[model samples]
Target: MEKRLSHVDDNNTPAMVNVSTKQTTLRTAKARSIIAVNDEILALIENGDIQSKKGPVFHTAIIAGTMGAKKAGDLIPLCHPIGMESCDISIEVIESKIVIYCTCSVTAKTGIEMEALTGASVAALTIYDMCKALSHNIVIEETRLISKTGGKKDYYHE
Candidate 1:
C-alpha cells in the first residue's frame, strides 16, 4: 500500500496536521549526525573540542541543537509549534569522525521526531561552521532519526 503524506490535504495542498483530538503523551526522539574530517583537523580536535572565536566547538553546537529543537516549528513549514520539555546533545569523536546525538522530549499530542532531526542537523552544521576554517575537507556524512517513542507507535534503529 502507498503511504499517504500527513502534511498533504485531499486537495493536494500542504497543511499542518491536527493533533488537537489526540491525547498528550510523553514523546521522545533521538537523532544522529556524523561528520568526517581529514587527519590534520582530527589532530586539532584531539582534546575532544576546538576553541573557536564563536566559543568552544562542541559547546556551541550543543546550545544550537537545543535551540533548534525548541524552534523546529518556526524552521519547518507545516510543523506544529511545540514546547519541548527537554533537549540534550552529545558530541563524541571516533577516529576521524565526529558523532553527534540529539535527543528531544515533549509532553504533547504529536511526536517530536522532526524536532530531534532539526536539532541534529543544526548541530552538525554548527560543527562544520566552526571547523571549516581549519580544513575544507570536512564532510557531514549523514543525519538520521535513531529512535522515537510514544504516539501510536515506537521505532528503534538497531
Candidate 2:
C-alpha cells in the first residue's frame, strides 16, 4: 500500500513538498458531500418554503463553496496555498439528503484536490448551519474526492 501521509520524510519531520520543479499544468478536481436533513426540512425544501426565511439555500451554498475553496489552505494545516482559476459548486436534493459537488480548477504546479474537497465540506456545513434551527438531527457525512486530473496520475470515478 502507498504511504498514507505526505509532507514528511522518513524521520517524520514536517516538510512541504517541493513542487517548484514540477510542470505547471491545468489541474482539476471534483469532490462530493452529503448532508442529511429531517422530514420537516425536506418538506420545506420541496415546497420552496426554504426561501421564505432566507434566500435560496443552494445558491448561498454555491457562493460559500467557492469562497471556501479559495481559503482551503488557510483553514487546513499543511495545505499549500494556491490560486484557483475557477471554482464551481452544485447542490441537489437526493431523497432526504442534500448532495453537494464541488469542482475546482487551476493552472499551477500542484493539484486542487484539497480545494475541491474543502469547498464541498464547507457547503455541507453551511446547509446544516442554516437548517439547524428547524432540527438538530442534520448530519454531514461522506465527503470524498470523486475525481482528480493532473499530477503524475489521473483518477476518475468508475
Question: How do the residues 40-129 of candidate 2 rate in per-residue lDDT, one tens digit apiece?
Answer: 888887443266366777777788888999999898787889989999898888888889999999999999999999999988887877
Show pairs that collide, candidate 2.
Answer: none
Candidate 2 structure lDDT? 0.87
lDDT of 1 by residue, 1-158 (tens): 68899999889999998888998999999999999988887776646788778789999999998888889999999889998999999999988889999999999999999999999999999989988988889899999999999888999999
Q: What is the lDDT of residue 81 in candidate 2?
A: 96
CA lDDT, every model vs. true structure: 0.91, 0.87
Q: Candidate 2: TM-score? A: 0.91
Cα lDDT, model 1, residue 73: 95
Per-model C-alpha RMSD: 1.3, 2.0
Candidate 1 wrongly placed segments (more than 4 Å): none
Clashes of each: 0, 0
Tell me, by TM-score, which candidate is best: 1
